[model samples]
Target: MRHRIKNSLALVGSIAVQTFRGDAPAGAAMPRFMERLKAIGRAQDVLTGDGEVSAQLRELVERALEPHRGGDCRRFRIEGPDLRLPEASATALAMALHELATNALKYGALSRDDGCVVVRWWVQADGSGGELRIEWREQGGPPVVSPARRGFGSGLVERALAAELHGRCVIAFEPAGVVCEIRAPLPRVAG
Candidate 1:
């Protein structure tokens, strides 16, 4: 319990310290930050108490986006194989998704009524077990513009998630919307 509490505090503190507080008012940012914390909680909720085990990837993605659905479920489309991910990887991916979704709500697709996001994943046969690839693409939103500075959110989504999953993550800011692609080697001994 103590360890978990410490970790939870550290994670929260890290985000507060690392997040880029722009010219936006606290009122506008508070809800987004709260949503992010809720996403982290949902991610942790999926972890089995047992030693490093697995959980459904689809579930994690759904829960991360649940708070953003507002009234219409049609805003987000999630399509992926029924695969399980290790607890750590699952948590990392969930966090990344939360960040992506928060950004969308504030500046991208979810900001517009007609915009939507697609979450898709697939597995490729590698020499070993296989490789998992997850894609997050937004469409029909405001014109996408890359941030002038790479914020901590991008670092967490790209570098932190890649490290946790032992894979690569790339986020693209196209004119249409934002796209995030992540690829990682499937753990040899999956749960």
Candidate 2:
């Protein structure tokens, strides 16, 4: 019974991670799970410990996602309000940004002394909700080709994040370099 309970708890936690954030496997109902978790957490926090605990939970969630923040990204220039996001969503965003920066730092713009990167974002109203506009531009890098298949970096930039955030990720390869843009939703609670 003890082992069964532990296993059940573990499964619940896993489901929460998969639903509230894109911390689950591919081909799953990514956004549905995230929405479910967000709604459940909001309800849970309403009656139990609220403000402080919610903030702390958000931080803990972000920390848990640190490992996924991998890539060859370099310098970044981010602009806009730091809206409070759920720990899980925040973690996903951080992971996405970190991956971009890491990739730039390694094989992309930051690879050369003459090369550099710019990261920027902004918040805008969208109908009833809001949207976040983010851009990552790489300069002084070699030419690039849109891969026939999504590479690891592409998967994170295009698929994982876009699916979870309900946004669009566009990558443009110019003779000068690569420029990537993302437009994702910013929920009221997240801000």
Top-scoring candidate (lDDT): 1
User: In order, what lDDT does every prediction score?
Assistant: 0.85, 0.54
Candidate 2 versus truth, CA RMSD in Å, comes to 9.8
- Tell me each candidate's RMSD, in Å, in order: 2.8, 9.8
- The Cα error of candidate 2 at residue 27, in Å, is 27
Q: What ranges in model 1 sit over 4 Å off? A: 1-9, 20-33, 48-52, 188-191
lDDT of 1: 0.85
lDDT of 2 by residue, 47-136 (tens): 234442123323332332233234423333334455555433443454455456555555677666667666666777779577877677
